[model samples]
Target: MTHETTRIHPAALMYAEEEKAGKLSRREFLARTTALGVTAATAYGLIGAAQPAQAGGHAQQGGTIRMQMEVRALKDPRTFDWPQIAYFAHGWLEYLIEYNNDGSFAPMLLSSWDVNDDATVYTLNVRPGVTWNDGTPFTAADVARNIEGWCDRNVEGNSMAGRFAVLIDDATGTAIEGGIEIVDDLTVRLNLPASDISLIAGMSDYPAAVTPANFDPENMLGNPVGTGPYLPEGLEVGVRATLVRNEGHDWWGYAEGKGAFLDRIEYIDYGTDPSAWVAAAAADEVDMFYETTGEFIEIIEGIGWERTEIASGASIVIRPNQLAEVDGMTPYADKRVRQAIAMAIDNNVVLELGYNDRGEVARNQHVGPMHPAWADVPRIEYNPARALELLTEAGMADFEMDIVSIDDDWRKNTTDAVAAQLRDAGFNVKRTIIPGSTFWNDWTKYPFSSTDWNHRPLDTQILGLAYRSGEAWNESGFANAEFDALLAQANAIADADARREVMAELQQIMTDEGVTIQPYWRSLYRHAKPGFVGWDMHIAYLPQMYKVGLAA
Candidate 1:
């Protein structure tokens, strides 16, 4: 059945009225409609009705939006539940004080904040009246508690603890002493030993979402409470998570004049394939889906559903474990050999097959043009001839390597393409595709493997996480004293120009040294039936339900 033929629920009808009245922008209209009880599919259809200019000129209210996901059991935002599969949980369950969009920090849970002299002190004013899912008031105490939990070695919150530890150490120039201090009931202050300009920017990630004092670390799957606009009403492991409106939450970042309208949101987890989720959306069985693939872009565009396409400002890279050793072998030990391997993969082909011409070729650098750090940095182009030369010069002319990747169809396709390109570049490349469940746990243990690294903060956070030794996600086992020193220097540099220069140098090192090879940047797209509204693309790539509603 065509998306247009799908019946628009009454909630969607309410949103449609607002659209016709030209009361809101396309994005605002979409956000309002989704909150009013419009299905995601129907919302997509409504968005597709007119160009962004004409379609976004309305305001709507009241709707239940249903979204789809491939795979399940990723309800917890904390811990290493599923590193690559927790976007849904992050979006629905947590609220970061600040957030980055197109590389700019915007306020979220915090009403306002300021960094002190040389980035050594940060004071944040928490928004009052915000409440957790359980109706507990959100306050500065919650923020302090969450930070302590993440940095506590005993808690082992997640892979991010190590990263936070680095920042804390840098700030205090000591072990994470008593750095977090509560200034007042709605204000918190952080004192660091050294300058850390990027610390505030990095802290604005979903993983840093505040947790209440009574929250249990072990049993967090069922009971999670945050200041977000939605609360988990039903949860079935390996199945789905149902969310209802957070009645006490009327403080969404975009809820200026109007408030959230919908009363419910249901996230259905299916298989890990885009096709499976697409089938569900097309059948009207699911409202929306996460992680759309390039192969399905064309199909979705012409399927008669309203669609919203936005740049996700993120890239997918295959991070090789630098720490893992096999049979006393360190294959990635030689930096030149790693560089050769990076040069061998043809990113252009991967972008075509995997991204469907929707994204730009990835430079080996972690930061993209969307980031302020990207300036005059040359893009890395595919050159198999040069790759062969590098491999030969490294004295590994006949090198044969096996690349490990998850068994998901998209990842399989990407790995196969890389293997073929490496073969053409005069290296023997074998692809090992394993099940998604097993791959997450075992791939990091493998000395040489290719795993996806998804959405992250800015260049500072990305570099700190991957390049800093002992970092939780530093599976690459990459360690350079010079890089570490430079990162430390950049963290303290308060001058924007100086910081940018330091960041540029870091990006150059990643590209020249080939710590990790980036193939392409990914864009986020959604498909829905017409008459739904109110879904805006954020840097984290998860749709915020409270900002959406249906037309009347």
Candidate 2:
């Protein structure tokens, strides 16, 4: 496919022309005019037109596909179950909504939805005729129950608690408020604290899964109930999750006349070692393997496996905890120290080892240029000499610090390279490999260490979780009142153009302050047997099982 230059909107061009004649840029002009956040014109322009699929071919049904995942658990969508396990269960469970292929918001369980003028109230229209695996009617009560579970402090239902807190009015910035209301049997309404357009889009695209109201969180071990086209057949925690077609599901709007084409989907979790999973796919032991690291792409393809390359939705960054002050001093508090660390590491070397030449180096401030509000930030090239100079100037040359990573070969290699680079830059570096289970647990407790974070939903989400005050994931303890204010303003702004300007400003602040040292973005490669087809590669690191089928 040929790459196209992003088309700036006509209004944007007019604004640019006006700016050239002694006014600010069109973006600035529009931001002033609407008094809203950055306008969506630029983002809308950046999004490429949907490409037409090849014609003359029809989809075939019927298949039982076996897949390998790194891990699994009891099929509970509402609980703090593993993501891989949730992805496997999502196939069997129906969601209240579903995302379209083009990333547009669409109705699945809900036939339609209405938003008030202020964008604070959202009324969802639930579809009728959907039944759970046990032949129970799916209703809005189920949606309300799921939302209540997420907002419940005692339940701790996965990351949704924090995420939902950001969306609800009473629930915003707090875990106690219940913002979801059940409006009769087929209708549900959500009242937000602020007007956020992105929330609606995110609800339709990501986080659309809705579990049954009757499914008990504490007692529903190894079993889940949903109105999805598939139902769980068997489940073994940390081992495998299997699903079979529900046959009773008829509510999905996106599927229309097409039901789940597969009869069964078996997700076999293989842990951090994707190499073993790749071997399984090559040996035909598994029909497909997901989130395959770039290093295994060649090996899988070399063995007659076909694969799909999806954009790595997330970037890998080294975060230094600023709250863990040593002798009344935060090492990362000094801008010079952070810059020095950023300049010391060689991203190309890490990419070579981790991605095997398939991934691209990230120089932009945001995760990708596709994000509407993204801006070009100053780049810090790899220069160990400069790094040492900065470290010395900051009087941190003798400072010893721990770079933490999970006890996995890939993470070990990454931290090792970072240690060597920092050492070469004249800083005392100690590499620590914490067990994977304990790493996540301790890292969140704000241990005095640096570690890697996975894919975050959006720039704002990451900012709120990592930089905002009192956030669970705020290990860095980096706080800026100005940054927080700007984020709040951006969240309420309705105009896309105005929002972009604020977002750009936010990115600039993070980069200039050296909040985190983002080096390389990670990519995913999926290897599947030629017989398998229709599986959607999700950027959220979750794979869709109901979409897959065997090509007879």
- Please, what is the whole-model Cα lDDT of each candidate in the order they appear? 0.61, 0.59
Expressed as tens digits, the lDDT of each residue in 1-552 for candidate 1 is 111234444434554566567643344344333322233345656646732232223536556777775444553344643422344454345555434232334345665565554557777667666666566778898877777666654443365565465435544433376688899988877777677756554555555655677766456556665556666576675577776765565545334343456677777777666777768877888766555666776676567766676665566666556555656766667776777778777788887775565778877677776543454576454677887787788776765677788766556776677778888888867778776656776544665666665555445667776567655667678788888888877767644345689888887778777787677777767666676666555556533455556654
Candidate that scores best on lDDT: 1
User: Each candidate: RMSD to true structure?
Assistant: 10.4, 7.0
- TM-scores, each model vs. reference: 0.80, 0.79
- Score candidate 2 by TM-score against the native: 0.79
Q: 1-552 in candidate 2: lDDT tens per residue?
A: 001224333444444455457444332343322111112333223232233331111346766777777454443454432356566657755555443333333345666666554556767667777667667887888767766655543443344554555453443333334457788998788777777544544443233467665565454435556666766776776677777776665535334654467777777766666677776776678878765665566777888878776554465556676666667777777888877877887778766664465666765243444344555655666788998898899988888877777765455666677677788777898877776545654565442444544444344655664676544456666788898788777766644456778887788777667667666666656777776666656555543555566664
Q: Ten residues in a row with the worst lDDT in model 1?
A: 50-59
lDDT of the structure predicted as candidate 1? 0.61
For candidate 1, the per-residue lDDT at 123 reads 70
As for model 2, its CA RMSD to the true structure in angstroms is 7.0
